[model samples]
Target: MDDTPVRVLIVDDQTLMRQGLRKLLEIEPGVTVSGAAASGQEALALLATTTVDVALVDAKMPGMDGVALIRRLAAEHPSVACVILTTFDDDEYIFGGLAAGARGFLLKDTPPDELVTTLRRAAAGETVLGSPAAERVVARLRTDPHGTGLEALSAREREVGDLIAQGAHNREIARRLFITEGTVKNHVTALLRKLGMRDRTQLALFLAKHRDQR
Candidate 1:
């Protein structure tokens, strides 16, 4: 494993929260606080110049909320992994963050060590949800085990979905399936549309919930 520390950017509207997070992460051996921003615009500005490996964002900022920030980051800085760190555990915020491209959704009460671990995992290209967030998703999966249009997916699309459920990103999926990364992305897009899902996290959970059906 690489010993290089993950560079994290903190984006929270609260001064105390941003400062506290920076202090907490700075004490960790394998994590570094790259910068702290008070809002989404500041975060975008900082991201334009700073080399951030992961963005730890609050879900309920004043101007551009965490979900919108993640969406912008997904389009503007695709390499920077995003994680939502917020006090709100409502389904709207949790699902919104995940659907908007956050690699992780963690409650503000998450342990310091777990937050650091989540940042590392997100930077490494794995979608991670904190324990509370995971429980909510699991409940949702139990209720909606089969998504709307799984039967419409082609065989290759099903393979891609399975790979996603196995925690494989596009590059890894491409390698495993003997296809180009571009092709893997195409399949992922198709799967998302066919399943009425917003992002890879939802697609993965949907596939995992209905694995027996496949």
Candidate 2:
């Protein structure tokens, strides 16, 4: 968030995996491994005493898995952003993690460069769900019987969604549309609620997938 390195906490049940992730994250510019934990309880406990900017959470672990941990930490540590890390290809994990308030979801095999990029993006307030998986998840949603369902948005809300689809961040959208950042945030939140979407990334995807109709 600042010129200093971004603080990250690795949460996994495996020591080796944690060590590997720490090493990889260290190689990235402006990111540091503040700590590591082998369980959800331990991670939550550590968060109580540490300054964690982002959390890389493992999907499968004993005593509170990644999805549950995301929900818990989101409620308890509103300042800390959670990004699920796992090898799970199941749709249930993807939908569940996003629904649980995970800002990003990365496969365990994500390349070091991409992992760093994802973390940086997440820290910047963008959801960086891993590529094809994120796309697939959103694709499944478009099949909703009510069509895109984005039509529920007001004219202003649709403008927000369209810019989001074009990859504009809140601040950028605010500047482009000549509105205050607070207004943009409000419109974005309203759009998400009206469309029944979880986050901005999903809203962006919806617009992108349906762009051809315009």
Against the true structure, whose lDDT is highest? 1
Off by over 4 Å in 1: 146-214
- What pairs collide in candidate 2? none
lDDT of 1: 0.86
- Model 2: number of backbone collisions: 0
lDDT (0 to 1) per candidate: 0.86, 0.80
Candidate 1: worst-modelled 10 consecutive residues by lDDT: 144-153
Error of 1 at 1 (Å): 1.8
lDDT by residue for model 2 over 10-113, one digit each (tens)?
A: 99999899998988888778998989999999999999899988999998898787877887887899788888889985655666677667888888888888
lDDT of 2: 0.80
Candidate 1 TM-score, true structure as reference: 0.68
Error of 2 at 117 (Å): 0.8
